[model samples]
Target chain A: MILSILAMAFREIRRHKMRSALTTLGIVIGVGSVVALVTVGEASSAKVRADMAAMGNNLLQVFPGSARRGPVRTLARPFQEEDALAIRREVGSLALVAPLATHSGVAVAGNSNHFTNVWGTTEDYVEARGFRIGRGRVFRDSEQGVAVCVLGNTVRDKLFGDRDPIGESVRIGSLSCQVIGTLQAKGANAWGSDQDDFILMPLRTVQRRLKGSRDVNSILVSVSRESAIPRVKSQIESLMRERRKIRPGQEADFFVHDMKEVAEAMQEVTGTMTALLGTIAAVSLLVGGIGIMNIMLVSVTERTREIGIRMAIGATAGEVLLQFLMEAVVLSLLGGLGGVLFGLAASLGMSAALGLPPVFVPWIIGVAFVFAAAVGVFFGFFPARKAAMLHPIEALRHE
Target chain B: MTPLISLRKVCRVYGAGETAVWALRDVDLEIDEGDFVAIMGPSGSGKSTCMNILGCLDTPTSGTYRFRGIDVGSLDRTQRALLRRHAIGFVFQGFQLLGRTTALENVELPLIYQRVPKRERRRRAMEMLDAVGLAGREHHTPAELSGGQQQRVAIARALVTRPSLLLADEPTGNLDSARKFEILDLLLRMNRERGVTVVMVTHEPEMGEQAARRIVFRDGRVESDERLRPLEARTA
Candidate 1:
């Protein structure tokens, strides 16, 4: 009996080839969209994780914009040089604390002139960021205005080739600096910006010779343990607040940048992207569902006499309903199974093309397949009922 | 033989407008077990309505209906369906097999409604398909079968449940002369060999001559019921 019903379902779907194809197109679209969106989101999250781990996983940032700003995005107050030194001196949970002075300038290295971002800091900056000098030693504290420079990996490759750029010289603004070190290559972060295209200098050299600014753009504070990050971040926030002399409820200019915090924002944005992508893709599935409904409706109309014949042969209303409902689910499920395969292949191809990691997100797979069955239930119910409620005598008389 | 079906003042009214017509009015008909009967009528006669009530597909407006000594008029929809599944088999004029379904599957439908198990249902359906002389054509869908083969398939479907009562609502209405003879031969064989009670509604006078008894209906009442002599028995 079960085989008979299944056979009937198969026959019905087969009879309407064009309609079946059109309906399957819906499932394909819905499942394809969901797969691609989720895979892309997974790839992005993976990228964020790699960045956080590379940028000293246990690091925390203290800024003036946070402690007094609640959860809002605003510049709180400037974190002075005194606060960073004080945190480094006072905090026992810290591994290292580095103050950053950043500015952008045009630099000329052997006729290769480009506008590049420059970061000046102490030796602790390299340790706190888990970066190695890749070629030469970092600058000495007393080498202020000594015109020594360290080239970023991209800058080094673009400026000097195989001739060893370690001894090369570059002009930054009015000051010409000799190459002291070359940075190791690091890839781009979750953001599309290049991570290895910046130039690093000593704090005093940048303060005195480059931008001539005493204010720091940001501070990097590294903790010795991951479990101690929150405690360390809160401690640094209060310390900065005390030193910056900011009143309660008043905004500060500085902010603490934490990996988890950045990840949360990244997750929200990725989530939105996933939904938008899935929603757009899911329209196809909904269309596929409607197609199933439409086909079932047509089948009901065509099989009026058949329904009447069955009723006369002792079929109850529930039995008739069950038969058609089973048929609809079977049809949609077959299409859904085919769609899963199609989506898998499409996502693999897309992932390779986009150069992102390929992930088969289980939640999406479950949602697509089960949701297709649900769609069968959702759309199939009405038509199935109509077929079941038919008066057997009337149906038999249909000409 | 006990009355296998009894209708007390059965009335089936069609349409609700000013042109409302009574298909069956105050019908009280009875058929004994293993009877071969034909309801003969013109196009507008009430024979079809009697067939519908007998098949349990229609309920009387103000009458009592009994099948196998059970009061069917009081039964709920579910109970009535159960009664139809086990007690009645229907053959239709147009041979209304579900399109694109194999002959075997179409024959298996009534058994499915009976909740027959998979293996048993298939076995019975195949057996009936073969019994109707469509032995090798079980896999062929209705569209792929000829008109005669399709009618045979409908007959097999009607008889699969081994129901005591078989109702054929103009069973050969759409068949060619040859196909109509083949169906009539199959129906007569079932009546004579298996002793299955058969009630047929047909407008053909020649077809009416084949049954053991002919009931002629006109308007909303029975015009005459004549005991027709079986061709072979009476001639022999």
Candidate 2:
């Protein structure tokens, strides 16, 4: 019985092809936009996570001042190399520590000049900051305060085209330094900053030969294990407070930042954005359901005589209800299927055009299809009931 | 044998209070098996109301109606529908065949409601279409068929379920004189050959003359009842 009713519904829908297609348009657009937006958002979040991971895993940075609270008011003097050495010796959860000082300058080699950032750090900077030596070796410990430098991939490409830069000499400011190594290629960071555009030299060399100062700007720390991050962070905070002479109930002169916090914040923002877009698209689906209800009511009124004929031919009210309800469900299901195809195509187009990774989420597709069928049932009820409750005699008498 | 239908003081009232209109008032009726009865009256004389009650499509406001020893007035809506589904068939004046459906599908509607298997349903529907002289026109929709052919399809649908009682309200009202007699002859043949009890409401005296029994209604009451010679015998 249900099969016959479904067949009748299919025939009826096929009879008025244009109206049925028009009614399903809203649902198609709704599901399509929902899928596209969620897929793009997920891909973007994954990109952020990858970028963060590339920066450094389980890494933290300690800055000298609480700059976020107000203007850069210096309550404590800048860090020295001794602070990094003390943290490495005292903290049990510490893996590696590097004190860093940075300055921007122009480097000249063989009549070629390029403006690049230069960093002063120890040998531990390579491991703590997740850098690799692509060509030559890192400077020896005994080579501190000597005129030795390492070039980043971008700096190497800019200053020395395709030639080998190892054992060569470059002029930094008024000082000449010998290049000892070249770092591997590390792409852009999460904030779109180029990470491989800087040069690294020994801390004592930058202090004595370049800056003529012993102040370090920041200190980088890597934890031994991911589960020990919180304990290590608290230890660094208290150690810094004691070393900077910060008493109880007083705000410390420094702050610690974990890379995981930034990743989590970015993930949260993307999740909220996806949900907002999904809600707006869901509203369109509701509007589509309303369109179905309107057309179904009109159909019931137009087919009153047919309803009378069926009733007289021994169709129960429940049977008539099921027939009309099935029609609405079939209509919405078709729309949903079309929407899924459109959504996948749109997502693929976006990924290709925007250079984003494609993300296919199975649950989103399942949810959208199920919701479309539910919309049919919820909105189609009133019209089907109206068709069922019609009086056979009065309906037959209707002109 | 038990009567096929019995009614006692059946009254059908519409509206309320000062605007109350009695469509049927204090009416009593009985019909036996294998009887072809014609209900004849002018417009607004309650003939259609009587037909509706007999077909189990409507219930009286004040009285008892029994069909095959079952109390129709006391039955719920679903039970009444079940009774109608199994034992009653109806044909209408407008040849109320579904517009877009084929002749075979229209005939198969009752069997579909009965949950008959697909193959059996097709065979039974095809047989009924062939019996109605529409063998080659089974696949033709109502729009593609002539008026007489559409009426024939409606009659085929009515008799497809092998119903014990057939109620037709002006089955030939929309047809020309030639098509009218053709449909009337078809109904007469069903009654005489198959022993099916038929109660038909018609406005024409000639159509009334074709029945084995004639009943006339006036002002919501029966005015005359007569048993006439079978039209088949008279014509012979």
Candidate 3:
């Protein structure tokens, strides 16, 4: 019986193809936009996480200042090389720690000079920040005072133009530094800034030659496991507070920034935006449901004689209701299927065009499909009841 | 033997109080098995209301209706529908064949509502269409068929369930004189050969004269009833 009723619904819909298509347009656009927005949003979040991983896996940084106290900023004393050593010694689950000092200068190599950033750190900087030695090896840990450097991909390209600069000597400010290696290319950071545009050297090299001070600007620390980052971060924070002579419950003179938190915050932001767009799209779906209801009502009115004929031929009110309800459900379901296909194509195209990794969440698709069918049920009920409640005599008499 | 249908002092009223319009007033009727009865009256004379009550499409406001010795007035809407589904068939003056549906599909509608299996329903619908002399036109839709052919399809649909009673409302009102007699002859043949009880409402006196018994209505009351021939005369 259900099969015949379904077949009857298909026949009726096919009879008025243009009207059926127009009726379902609302549902199609509603489900389509929701699916596309969610898919693209997930892809963007995943891309941000990937960029965070590229920055460094489970990496944290300690800067020499509290974030804010009563909206009045205060600058604290800089960290020292001993602070990095202290974190490495005291913090459990510690992977590596590198005290970083930075200086900007023009390096001249055989008349090809390039203004570049120079990062002064230990050999552990390569592992702590997820950089790989592209050509030559990193400097030894014992070579703290040695005037040796590793050129970043961009700096090497500017100075040597694809030529090997492993054993080349470059003049930096007033010192002649030999390039011992070149780091691999890392495209960009999360903020769309060039990441492979700096030169790396020993911490003492920049501190003595450029700054002429023993001040360390920042300390980079990597945790062995992602689950251990919070524990290690707290340990390093307390240790820094103690080292800087800050009492308990007092505003510390240092801040520990965890990269994992940054990644999670990025995900949360994208998720919120996706939900916002999905809700707006769902409103359109409700409007589309109204469209279906309106058309179903019109259909019931127009087919009054047909309904009367069926009633006279022994169809019960329940059977009549089921027939019309099935029609509405089938219409919305078809629209949902079309929307799914349209959304997949739209998301895939948008992700490809925007250079985001395409991500399709299966559960969202299932939910959208079910929600569309539910819309049909909710909106189709009144019209079906109207059809079923019709009087056979009056309906047959309808011209 | 108990009559196949009985209506005892039935009254069907519309609206209420001073505006009340009595469609059927103090009407009493009975129809035995295999009888061909024609109910004739002018518009507003309540012949249609009588047909509706007989078909179980409407119930009287005040009196009792029985079918096969079961009290129909006590039955609910669903039970009335069940009674109609299992025992009665209807043919309308407008034919009422669903537009855009094939003749075969229109004939199979009652069987579909009866939850008949697909193959058997199709076979039975085909046999009924063949019985109605529309065997080769099964796939033609109502719009594609002529007035006579559409009426034939409607009749095939009405009888596909092989119901015990067939109620037709102005079954020939829309046809030409030539087609009119053709349809009248078909109804008479079903009554005589298959012993199916047929109650029809018609306006034309010539049409009413062919029935074994003719009942005339005026102002919601039975005015005249005459038996034109014996029941065994048509069969013999």
User: Considering every candidate listed, which one attains the maximal lDDT?
Assistant: 3
User: DockQ for the candidate 2 complex?
Assistant: 0.78
Off by over 4 Å in 2: A67-72, B230-236
Off by over 4 Å in 3: A66-74, B233-236
DockQ of candidate 1 compared with the true complex? 0.63
The candidates' DockQ values read 0.63, 0.78, 0.83
Rank by DockQ, highest first.
3, 2, 1
| Residue range B63-93, candidate 2, lDDT tens digits | 9898998989998777778888889989888
Write candidate 2's Cα lDDT for A1-399 as tens digits: 778899988999999999999988887888788778877887788788888877877898988775323665545568988888888988888888988988879999998999998898888888877888899988867888989999999999999989999999999999899999999988887677899998889888888889999988889999989899999999999998888878888887788988889898988888898899888888999999999999999999999999888888888899999999999988888888888888889988987786677889888789778978998898888899999999988888877
From the highest lDDT down, the ranking of the candidates is: 3, 2, 1
Displacement of residue A345 (Cα, Å) in model 2 is: 1.4
lDDT of 1 by residue, A330-374 (tens): 777777777777777887887788677777677877777797788
The deviation in Å at residue A309 for candidate 3 is 0.7
Candidate 1 residue runs with Cα over 4 Å from true position: A62-81, A103-114, A139-149, A167-180, A208-217, A225-231, A245-253, A349-355, B15-19, B115-123, B134-149, B174-182, B228-236
Evaluated on the second chain alone, the candidates' TM-scores are 0.93, 0.96, 0.97
